[model samples]
Target: MADYLDFVGDPGRDDVEGWLYPTDAHLMSVVNDLQVDRGFRGDVLEIGAYKGKSAILLGFFPEAGESLTVCDIFDSGAPVSDGNARENTAFYPGLLQTDFEKNYLRFHDRLPRVHVGPSEELGEIVAPGSCRLVHIDGGHTYEVARADMETARRALGPAGIVVVDDWSSAHIPGVAMALWERYLTGELIPLAFTKGKFYATWDPAGLTAGEVADAVATRPGIEASGTVRLGRYAAAGVTMTPGDWQRYNAGLRAVYSKLYADGGASAPQRVGF
Candidate 1:
C-alpha cells in the first residue's frame, strides 16, 4: 500500500516540481482531514492537471471503488480561442500526457482516469454528484473558468469540496472574477484561500469555511488569519512560514538535481503514448 507520507514527502516533491502553488503541506493537511479524519467519501476530479502535480495529491486519498479523474488538453493542441488560455498553453515548452503519467507513476502504481481534452467537456464525461473534491486549475480565461466552475458544481456530491487554482493571482484575474461572481450570486460559498487556490463548497450541511479555517490554524508551520464571515460562509487567508517554504523548496531541488545527474537533464520529456 502507498503510504500518505510517501505522497507528502520526496515523491510529492519530485512529482510536483514546485508547480502546486498552495504549498504541498497545506493541501495535504486539508485532504487528510477531508478523507481520513472526516471520512468524506467519493471519487476525486481535477479539471486542470499540469504534469500531475496537484493531481497526484488528489490520487492519494481515493479508497477502493473510487477513482481519480484528471482532465487536461495535454498534446491535443491549444484551444481555438485567442485569449489568456491560448497564450499560457503556448508559453509552456511542451504539454504532454506522457510526462504527466511518468511523474504520477513515480509515486503511485497507476495513473488516474485521464480525459485528454478541453475541461468544458468534463460534465459530459463525469457523472453528476460523484466527486468528493473537484479541482479547477485548467484555463485562466473567464469563459474556461466559468465553464469549469459550473462543471464542478454539477460534479460534486454532498460534502464535496471544490478548489480553484490561481483564484486571486494578479496574472489570472479572470479566475478571480469568475469565482467572485459565483459567490456574489450565492452559487458557491467561500471556504478559504491559499497563496494560489480558493476552496469553496455547495453543500450547506457539509464542512463550512469557518471549520476549514479552524482546522488550518491547528496545523504547524501554517499561519492562518482570523476568519471573516461573508454572508452565509466564512473565509481566511493562509500562508506557510519562511522556514517551511525553504525546506519544501530544498526537497524539490534535491530531487530534480538527482534526476538531472542521472538523466543529463533535470526535467523529464514526454514518453510516447
Candidate 2:
C-alpha cells in the first residue's frame, strides 16, 4: 500500500499540489474506516475535483473490484448559472484536467474515470446504486446542489455515504439549504460535519460519524467531544481553528518529507491528537 501519510499531510502545500482543506484528515479517517476497516464494497464517486486533492484520498480506499469516478467541468466550457460562473472564474480559473491527472498520478498509478462536463450528465455516465461514497462539491447554487444530492442518492448503494462540501459555509448557504431540506424530508440522515464537508447517508445503520469524530479527538492535540448531536444524527467539528491546523500540518509535513527524503521507512507516525 502507498504511504497515505506521505501524500496527504497537507495537500495544499507545494509538495502535495492541490487545494484540500485541513479538515480533510478527519474526512479521510471517516472514509478509511468505512471502506477499509468495515469492508464496505462499491465504487467511489466525486462530482467536483479541482485538482484531485480529495480525489487522491478517495482513490486510496477503493478495493480491488471498485472504481473511482470523477466528474468535473475541466475546461469543458459548459454553460453554468451566473453565480456559479462567477465563483468558478474567481476560484478555479486555472482548473484543467491535465493538472488534475498529473497530481493524481503522483499517488495513484491509474487515473480515475473522468467525466468532463456538467454534473447533470452524471446519470448517463455512472450507474445507479453503484457508489459506496459520493462527494458533492461541484456547484454552490441551490439548484445544482439539490440536483447533485439527488444524483448522489441515486448512485449510492446500501450503507453508502454522500459528502457535500461547503455545506455550512456562510458564503455558500445554498449547500446548507439543499442538505437540510433533504435531511428534513428523510432523504438523508446526517452523519457528520467537517470544516468544509457534510457527511450523510440513507441508512440509519451507518451512524459512524460520532466514531470518526471520537477517533480524531484521540489525535495528539485535538480536544475531545468534537462530535455534536444534530437531532437524530451526529456532526463532527474541528477543535482547532483552520489557521492553527494548517500551521501544525505544515510542520508535520516538513518533518515527514525530511524523514522520507533520508531514505527512511514510511510507517504510520502519530502526531498531535
Candidate 3:
C-alpha cells in the first residue's frame, strides 16, 4: 500500500496546507502502519478535520475493509460553548466544510464519513469499541476537551490509540488540565507525547506504551527523550520542532546524495514512509 508521504511528496519540498507538523505526520503514519502490519483492522476517527491535512493522511492508511470518519462544526455555529465559539472564530476564521472537502478530494477519491457538529456528538454517532484510532482535536476548553476525551474512550476498542491535540499548550491549559485529570484517574494509559499532541490508549491489552514508543523511534526525525513520569507510570517523550525537522531534512538530503555518489544508480533514491 502507498504511504501518505508517497502521495504528498517530500515534506521539505512539497508542502501541504494546515497545521500538521512534519514530525507529527510521520508519527501518525507509523502508528497506523504498525497496526496494519500486525493484521489489526478497524475503523479510524478524527474529531477535528481542520482543512483535511491530517485527515488526508488518515484516509490513506485505512485498509479495504476499514473505514474513516471525521467530525467538525464547520461554519455551523454548532459549538457548545462560548470559549469554543471564540476559538473557531479566532483560529478558524471563514472556514467552511467545502474547504476541508476540497483539500481532501485532491488526494483521496472519496471523503470519509463526515459529521458536521460538535465533537460531543461523536460518542453517539461512532459505535463504542469500534475504532482503532481516535484523534481528538476538537475544542480546546476544559469542558469540551474532557467531553472529547470521554468520547474517545467510548469509541475505542481494547488497546486502541487516542491522540489529543494541544494537550499541553501553554495557552490551552484547559486541555492540559482535562488531559491530566484523565491520565491521573481515568483508564487512558499514556503512550507518548510530542510537542503538540499526547498519545494514549484506553487499554494496554491490545497495545502497550512500550510498543508505541518503539514504533515512534522507527519514524524519521523523531528523537526519543526518555520517558515522562505520570505518578508511578511513565510515558515516552519525543522532541522535534520545525527547526529540528529542517535539520533532519537537510541531513537526509546529504545522506541520499552521498549514497548516489558512492554507489551510482544502485543506491536507492528514497523509500516509502
lDDT of each: 0.73, 0.74, 0.77
Model 1, C-alpha of 234: deviation from truth (Å): 2.1
Candidate 3 residue-wise lDDT at 101 = 94
Tens digits of per-residue lDDT for model 1, 1-273 = 134334454433343443564343465457557555677788889887878767777777788889999998878774646784555556555767898898889878988899988887787889999998888887888887888889998999988888888786797699998888889988687777776777888888888766776777676656665577778767887776567657765765666677788668646321100
Residue 27 in candidate 3 has what lDDT?
Answer: 73
| Total residue pair clashes for candidate 2 | 6
| lDDT of candidate 2 over 177-269, digit per residue (tens) | 998999898557776665667777896665466666666666543333356777776676655455556676777777677768868866332
Candidate 3 stretches with Cα past 4 Å from truth are 1-3, 6-15, 241-244, 248-273
lDDT of 2 at 33: 64
* Prediction-by-prediction clash tally: 0, 6, 0
lDDT agreement of model 3 with the native: 0.77
Best candidate according to TM-score? 3
User: Each model's RMSD to truth, in Å?
Assistant: 5.1, 6.9, 8.2
Worst 10 residues of 1 by lDDT: 264-273
TM-scores for all predictions: 0.82, 0.81, 0.83
* Model 2, global lDDT: 0.74
Model 3: per-residue lDDT, tens digit, 1-273? 245664343543433456566556767777887787777767999998878878998888778888999999887777368898788778778888998999888788988999999887777779888888988888899998889888888888856888888886798899999988998785668878788788888676776667777887776566667887887668877766346656656755765676578667443323221
